[model samples]
Every structure is written in C-alpha cells, then in structure tokens.
Target: MKSYIISENRDSFLGMKLAGIQGIYVRDTADIEKAFKGALKNPEIGIIYLTEKAYLKIEDLVLESKRKNLFPLITVIPDRYGYERQQGVITQYIKESVGL
Candidate 1:
C-alpha cells in the first residue's frame, strides 16, 4: 500500500513527490473530486492526503467515507502557502472542540 496526495499547489505536490509520495496536481474542483474518487477506489492506496483547497471542495464526500470507515485513511493537509486559516486556526480548533 502507498500514500497519495491530491493537491492544488504545484510546489507542495512536487515536494511530496520528492518524499516518495505520489499525487495529482489538480487545477479545479472537478479535477480534485475525480482524483479523490480514484484514490478512494484504489485498494493499494493506504493514505489519501488532500490539500486544504482540494479537501474543502469535497469535504462532505470525504467525511462520508470516514464515517463509513472505508479503507485508505483520508487526511486534510496544508498547501505550500500553509494553512488557509492562518489567523485564529488554533482558536477555531479549540472552540470547535470545546463546543464554545
């Protein structure tokens, strides 16, 4: 089994490739969804890493797969520019966790 990434950032995709992880650099939401589905369908894929942008485009689908406890863990990751919610990201996480 191997890990795959669905990224919208070319730099991040290349960097991950250098680390020996294969991935697809998606240009649009359609491409992101397609790549995500393909990754999910692959039994050889052990982990599916999605850049923030790509994950957001298909958040519901990913969540559904997670709830179903499907194979190949799905994870959301930041891009080359880092997290989109730079300001208050920690705060947001805490708030969500605390239900505040």
Candidate 2:
C-alpha cells in the first residue's frame, strides 16, 4: 500500500518524490483525468494525492470516486501557492457530511 502523488507542477511532484511517494505530473484537464483514473485502478496504490489546481478541474470525478469506492483514498494537496479553498474547508465538509 503506497501513496501516489499526481501533481500539476514540477515542484510539487519533486517535493512528494523526496517523501518517497511515486506519481505523475499532468498538464491539462484531460491529463488530470487520465492520471487520476490510472491511480484508482492501481492496486498497489492505497492513497492518491492530487495538487489543488489539478483537483479543482476533476472534482466531480473525485467526489464520484469517493462515493463509489473504498480503496485508494483521494486527497487534495496545496502546492507552493498554498490552499485554494476558504479556511475551515474541512470543518465545512464535516458539517455537511454530518448534516449539521
């Protein structure tokens, strides 16, 4: 069970690489979709990390995958630019998921 990173930039990709996570670097939205689907299909990868910008493009697929699958957990990572979402995003998600 290994963690994979699908980063949009070289910096993020290299940074994760230093941490021993293997992954791909994508440019366009199509590439993002391709890499994301590939990661989901990989039995060896237990977690998938997508850069924030990359994740923003295929969020529907991410959410759909989350609802339909239990393995290969999907995560959004901020690049050098930092988080794209407003503060308390996790809290909001928890509230939404908990119906509160």
lDDT of each: 0.82, 0.86
lDDT of 1 at 76: 71
Clashing pairs in 2: none
Q: What is the lDDT of residue 10 in candidate 1?
A: 92
Give per-residue CA lDDT, model 2, range 7-65, as digits (tens).
89889999999989999988899999999999999899999998989988998898788
Candidate 2 residue runs with Cα over 4 Å from true position:
92-100
Candidate 2: minimum summed lDDT over ten consecutive residues — where? 91-100
Query: Which numbered prediction scores highest in lDDT against the true structure?
Result: 2
Instruction: Give TM-scores for every candidate, taking all chains together and pairing residue i with residue i.
Output: 0.82, 0.89
TM-score of 1: 0.82
Q: Write the per-residue lDDT of candidate 1 for residues 1-100, one digit (tens) a residue.
A: 9999999989989999999999999888888988988888888999999888887888777777776654777777788788986888778545533434
RMSD of each: 3.5, 2.3
